[model samples]
Target: MLKENKYCCEDHVDMAFDDFLVEKETFPCLEKSEDSKCSYCNKKAEYVLKLPS
Candidate 1:
């Protein structure tokens, strides 16, 4: 079951699903950036998973 949307860190503050898509689309090279750390664990977000709504 899906629980409430949970963010691991403040970087994802107020970010919606669409926002994630837009960010991914707009910044395709973010994966190579040092600042692209995971909002929860501070690890690198090497991949993005799109869950069904």
Candidate 2:
């Protein structure tokens, strides 16, 4: 199943951190679409930030 990440404008500017109940093989959930729109605001994303834990 395609997990849906909870998006909060206050927490981030672009894509939100995916709260995957299951374990993922990858890290740094940040992403960008071809349209260049902010996944949270639907506006132009200033930049993409990748933070891995």
lDDT of 2: 0.43
Tens-place lDDT digits, model 1, residues 1-53: 43222232344433534455554443221212333455457765443333334
Off by over 4 Å in 1: 1-35, 48-53
Could you tell me the lDDT of residue 12 within candidate 2? Answer: 56
Cα miss at 41, model 1 (Å)? 0.3
Residue 43 lDDT in candidate 1: 60
Clash count (model 1, backbone only): 2
Give the range of the ten consecutive residues with the poorest summed lDDT in model 2. Answer: 14-23
RMSD of 1: 11.4
| TM-score, prediction 2 | 0.30
In model 1, the worst 10-residue window by lDDT is 26-35
